[model samples]
Target: MDVSNAFLHGHLEGQVFYQQPTSFIDSAHPDHLTFRSTLSDASLFVYRQGSTTAYLLLYVDDIILTASTADLLRQLTDRLRAEFALKDLGPLHYFLGIEVVRRADGFFLHQRNYAHELLDRAGMLNCKPAATPVDTEAKLSTTDGTLASDASSYRSIVGALQYLTLTRPELQYHSAGVPPYARLT
Candidate 1:
């Protein structure tokens, strides 16, 4: 489910000051102290009842909630709706570039589309798939290859691959070896 204006719903703790925009200057408070809250994995909260557990994963404005029982899920959704304006997008299908498919046994999460997009962004959509993401025998040296002209694009692809490893653990080892940006000494 998606929360409308999720960031605005969060409670601001510390004091934050901001100058008024030239167009929308508030006469009451020309210079205002605004409070904003940022969400992270550390903000996740779990509720357990006996063997049943409900998990709440929060990533900024997006939230994924799962429970062992329908009743628990309903209760949690109601509580969240009461606290914040929520738009129920029905069963989870796509989230954070990960496509979720429901199976009789459980759910299957895949990033096939995301991977394709990444490849396209890297101009490697037509590239052949290798048995391994990285060659085990090949030695990568900083001085071996010339620097890429588009360093930002290289970094972007590497960053995306790092995120893709979240669902594909096998790629973790390969992705970990890649530096965000290439450097030559």
Candidate 2:
């Protein structure tokens, strides 16, 4: 779900003042009820009461909500709509570069489009696919390979891959090897 002017939904505490942006105006709106977040991830908020349970994932102004039941989902959406301007984006297909494919038994999530864009940006879309992205047995060293002529491009790709780790955790192991080479540039 997309929140319209989501930033405007925050409640300012105490005396908060800042130079307004171009054509900005002070407006007030009630924020959502307090939801508990786990220690592992602050962005994921869980709301549970009696037999009803709902999970709310907050990423910047975007929100992804799911419930234990269809009725609960409607109730949750209605409650949120009462407090904030929410535009339901319909079924979840893509968010934050990750694509979600809903199946009869489960949801399949992948970053194929994101990874494709990353490779396309890196000019390696035609590169052959390997069994593994990195050689797990190989030792890594910054000075092993020649310095990257385009260090900025290399850094940008590395950063994008770091975000990709959200789904492709296996890349994280090989990830460390790339950063060390960044300094070599």
- C-alpha lDDT (0 to 100) for residue 121 of candidate 1: 94
lDDT of 2 by residue, 1-185 (tens): 99899777588789987753433333553344445776788789887867988899999889999989999899889999987889999989999987889899999877777887898998988876554566679988977989878999999998897887755666555444353222211
How far residue 122's Cα lies from its native spot in candidate 1, in Å, is 0.7
Off by over 4 Å in 2: 7-32, 130-153, 172-185
**Candidate 1: count of backbone clashes, pairs at least 3 residues apart or interchain:** 0
Instruction: In candidate 1, list every pair of residues with a backbone clash.
Output: none
Lowest lDDT 10-residue stretch of candidate 2: 176-185
- In the range 5-111, model 1's lDDT, one tens digit per residue, is 86775687899887644346457866432222224445465667667778887777788888899998898889789878999988999998888899999988777
Clashing pairs in 2: none
Residue 69, candidate 1: C-alpha displacement in angstroms: 2.9
For model 1, the superposed segments whose C-alpha errors exceed 4 Å read 7-44, 49-52, 132-145, 172-185
TM-score of each: 0.63, 0.67
Residue 158 deviation, candidate 1, in Å? 0.8
Clashes of each: 0, 0
